[model samples]
Target: MSRATRRGGTGRSLRTTFSIARPHLRGHGLLIAGGMATLLVEVVLRVLEPWPIKVVVDAVSVSLGADSGATAGLPAATVPLLLACGVLLLGLVGLRAIAQYCSTIAFALVGSRVATALRARVFAHLQSLGLGYHSHAKAGDTVQRVIGDIGRLQEVAVTAGLPLVGNIVTLVVLSVVMLVLDPLLAVVVLLAAGAYLLLSRRGAPRITAAARSTRRSEGDLANTAAETLGAIRVVQAYGLEGQRAEAFDRGNARALSQGVKSRRLAAALERSTDVIVGLALAVVLVAGGWRVIDGAMTPGDLVIFTMYLKIALRPLKDLAKYTGRIARATASGERVAELLEERVDIADRPGTPPLGPVSGDIRFDAVTVDDGHGRRLFDELTLDIAAGETVCLLGPSGAGKSTLAGLLTRTSDPFSGAVRIDGVDVRDATVSSVRGSVTVVLQESVLFAASVRDNIRAGRPDASDADVERAARRALAHDFVTALPRGYDTVLGGRGDTLSGGQRQRIAIARALLRDAPIVVLDEATTGLDPAARAAVAASIAELTRGRTTLSVTHDATSVRDADRIVWLEDGRIVEDGTPRSLLADPGSRVAAWFRESLQEAS
Candidate 1:
């Protein structure tokens, strides 16, 4: 990953990137072929363009009595001959222009189609990645790869990738023609090209290294911005704006430095190529001059040699410029490939069937779970909840309360054992079907920027608007929703931040109600609300869990009062399990002690 220690590294990265792009390039082969065909046509016309000028020069030399020696097959220098040369030159230019235009458009279309396909594929893959992966990923950096990096690929495909491909082909053809014209002069042209290639090869690693560094710094800057903006409330509350700005500036400065270095290196390479080309032109002119003086070659032949060298110089110089472009684009491609190639750990086992209708018998069968840091959460622990039972889990922070809920939901799989609905193990069934049978309301309800009705219906997409309204009314959200500017049709702000904490909770509970799943999970669903809001959300939760098998994970001692059973957990094992009344009946019990603490805090 450093700037040095390997040349093969760049080559390997490019090969991997192209392999990733291969699937996206399918079905566009014919269009690409047609584009290359046009490129070949343009090359042929360019080589022929100098021929008419050669004929005119040879005839003029013969007429002036300067090259009766070498102008052996010269055309007569007359009015008709000069007119024909002019017409032929104009025709060749016009045809080459048409070919160039066609090739450009064709490649542009393929670039657009392929980039679009890749963006969509990368986005979908990110969505399907396991929660474990997302937990550690920075959303802003991921967004840049999906949007900014892929966009560069599409742009370079037209401006750099396509042009470079054509120029390379043109270089090869022109070199062949020069050799055919005169092998001795062709050596000078070919040697110039080889030197340029060697110079670029020597400089490529530095360019690639700089490009990769720039991309990484930019991604870090994006991550910094996203993190700062997302926590703006905390920042303002703590008056840490200066600190955040300082962090942002550091990342921004690094990105600017790397970016400038990359551009500077590329510019230096191009200017160096200019000197090489000038030397080659000088050498060819001197050598061609001697041949003409000795009558070994005609003046027109020397003109053709110099003209072809100039023509070939364009691609040679352009090669240096476009190589820098390819390096930057390849850095972006490496990032994209890394994302697309992430391992999917939480997907369903192949051939697993979808879940059948469930009566809500939940079981954790001797489960051994890890917290991803080698810490054991549940070691050989077994628990079961019968149909329509309400089981509440009480635990301190990091005691695996929410982690327990995650297990049933399959957010992350257990190290061993099975989580089952009825007799069906969750992992033995399709992930979508297993999750569809359960509804969870989290501590902070996440809502999208969509109409109130649409957000609630995300629970069950087939739910009618009337069903949405009924669910909202049940959750005590209907009144506020109706008071909005457009009632249920009103759109919410990002994460439903437009609403109060209580209002958001009600809407989330309404969504859970609309789902009407057989299994329900309430993960501290009423923790942050005021007393009044808590009461209202509690009533809504009561209705949602009326006939379902409910598992409420909580730190609030008061909320466990309504459960049929209370299980107290600590350090990944259950310390106490019994009916709430029995646990309260014992003054020394953890539940009783917790209830006392809650009452003291309230007072």
Candidate 2:
């Protein structure tokens, strides 16, 4: 069987579930232990609680009847005895309440801590996963697993675990007590509980299936909503709101249907348990009454026997109720476990050393790579760029210009060959070290929802305010940034949507400049800008590229003319490599034709 099949199937066993939570439990061992201890004390007190009522009943019966040998040495006035029983009953209940409170608080604290730790771990893991894993994964589905599924596990810790364990302990203690007091009545109670367990097991598979379906449907609904909202601008511009709503409604309806089926099964189990418990109680009552009338047992003895029977069977009812919760938690746990099992394909090799500062010499050594779909993009391709040299990669779309940059940044690895920086193979260096030496400014400027200063400082978190301003000034973004409402402190909306495209690009340039890395990648950075914006960004690029080994991927004639050399790629090979002016001056050259077509499109 496949790994996923084994993990998604048998990996959800009770032992596996606890293993997932074990670290957090161990971290807060004292609190969890205290909670269990408190629960155990509460259970013992509950077992003793009914005895006070039995004492009162026996005392009253002795007072009303002729004074028998059993009461010969007892107090003549039963009021004092009744009062003492009442006080003892009050003390037991009050103490039990305090224990319950402590246990609840302790368990809740442990649950919250576990949930917080798990969320952080899952989030960090997701961030560490390779781009290839994320490309095929849905954002909404991932969010559901991280948030909704983990949240369910938290509930299992507090609600399902403690209660189930506590109830089982209570039931066991009560059963032993009942058996000692009256074995025949205890046998009937045990038989009823056994039947309830059988019925619950019979219904478990269906309930589990329905719950899994419901969780999956909810994930789908979350995905649909997130996708639509993330692209709300496109959806609204294209009038797709009604369509998105219809899709969401379909998923929501399916979730509702599955949830109802799960709840119905759970409810049926609970009602069946109630009926079984009630019949057991009636049987014990009828038998004990006959024993009382025949002088075989006292009325108080009958009362205590019935009370213990109720206590023993109460957990059976709870077991039926908690079955649905456990099933839901199991489904959620499976999803979480699957995500956690995802391997980090692009991580640094074990014992890999950190790379030192680079002198900016880069080489691709007989590299071969495919586009992850068996389509070869490079085959034994070799290239070299010297220190401080600016090379422009010219190509038609899908000619693998961006793929080259991805290799340099360690975003993805070559199929069979090595990418080297400063004569050191990237695969032999720590991933962070390799990436830290390069800065990239993509076609679309990516920014978080934060102040402009923070966005620029993201390139170097330790950069001072003065350093940030200096970088922005170099990118020609200082003037506009100062004019904003809060200047450098102005908060941008998601993706920095409040800024114009050129403004965003300038900020991106400022960010790259602040990194001060030895190597830079400008991937179609000026492709979609207006004339004024392009000029501003181009000037910033010219400043940033100076003294740095830069790779410019573009079809723009201006960016090409500014490059020291142009490498024109066609069919996974370099068809032309020379000064841009030399290539453009050749009339019969494909590079010249490509440049002419690009200039014509721009005009």
Candidate 3:
């Protein structure tokens, strides 16, 4: 299928555009209505704008006429008549400017509000999509849709929709007035407009396709830049700057080519409109001038007819110019719509009760989980941990340790069977409630660019300063945080890059500690730390696990030694389960042998 076909084509795209924009527009109905009202006033002023010029032309003609008797019957002299017309011209111009200003401001306000609301909604929807979707999705592409595409919708509202509507309205009103003034001239104008419309319609599909391509190219370019920049450290370490630059250049070139094609098409359409309009004006001038020479029309009447025709057809000229903008916006809207339409696979079932405070008893009942391919990571796996139990999950990589933790957090559901906390099926409880009962620190600690205190308080937004300090102390991060230039208020760099590896881990621990969830998970929290840092983090881990039901996934024998029970897995089945001391004392045990090997490797 063609790219356009895959994206539902231009017609469907326009429909999707309206569907996404309708709610935002409706939300600010009062603002939209006020904008339209101003537009109406502006159109009215535009229609009346030509009358003062017509008056000036008539007065000038009479003043220079051979018949001085024409002024004898007039209420005022020709000089005063000319002066009055000039003043009226100024008034009309001033009033029209004011009306246009109001209309533009009103429409801009509505457009900005719509953009802000849609951006927020898109961001929230992305967050709600859960880990599974995000894991497989590109962060750069998602960011492009949320930020870039939504931004285009704002431009369409103000730069395309408002102007298009206002121009169409002005054309309609002026067309009526043209018919009243001269039927023959009006027909000429209508025929020219119809021809322009037909020509524009013929080119619409091409323009739409080119615009879609351009938008897609821009998204690819953005994705390329985001990915390369995000992996800059890796790129520099591997000396892959040249390769990355070449990739970005290719994407940039494609975007530029597409953009040029779209603009070229738009320019062609605009030039065609100008030629057609010029022809129509020439026909009007020739026909009206002949009538004037034949004594069938006045000069002032001819002037009015031509002025009105130009005013009526002005929007058609603008319409041709804005066609590409509208098509580009349609393309962007389709991308945004696709994101908003994504199904939230992980969400609370209807009427599911909130999981209250738990005693932290966790169980996996006859659980079977697949790796999303053909491999079954867990088959009828059943395990139980008592309240406040510190269980260490010991296994080689790919033995489904992290998957098990994912199941507990409801990050991914089991293929068949149930995961429960305190005897309540996780699926039967609200996702928020389940998450509220568990706190996890991943192998790689993730931190945002924020003040140290705010980062900790993210675990519990209601945490007071003292509460934050208490959690930091428990995680052994309080002393260092206070030693910083701004103490707890010191802002960290992106991903907390300003802090040491061990410091970041401790801050993460503090965050989890602040949550004070009954169940805690440490996924190899001490894997990469040096001896001293590891010792410090291990101490913090001890403090964090003191009263909580802790599940630690680790290869560190030190961590395993402190566990109340050790569960060993091989090929997704539990090979052994026992107290660490009992298991280590058994020389023939596979778990003991694995631990011994891990310790020797460390040495």
Output the worst ten-in-a-row residue range by lDDT, candidate 2.
Answer: 1-10
The TM-score-based order of candidates, best leading, equals 1, 2, 3
Which regions of candidate 1 deviate over 4 angstroms? 1-8
* Worst 10-residue lDDT window, candidate 1: 1-10
Model 2, position 311, has a per-residue lDDT of 81
lDDT of 2: 0.86
The positional error of residue 40 in candidate 3, measured at the CA in angstroms, is 0.8
Query: Candidate 3 lDDT, tens digit per residue, 72-101?
Result: 222323777778778988888898888878
Candidate 2 vs 3: which has more TM-score: 2
Candidate 2 residue lDDT tens string, 229-250: 9899999999999999999999
What lDDT is obtained when candidate 3 is compared to the true structure?
0.86
Instruction: Provide the overall lDDT of each model, using Cα atoms, as 2-decimal numbers.
Output: 0.88, 0.86, 0.86
| Clashing residue pairs for model 3 | none
Q: Mind giving the per-residue lDDT tens digits that candidate 1 earns over 475-552?
A: 889999999999999999888989999899999999999999999999999998899999888999999999999999
Off-target runs (Cα >4 Å) in candidate 2 are: 1-13, 66-77
Q: How accurate is candidate 1 locally (lDDT)?
A: 0.88
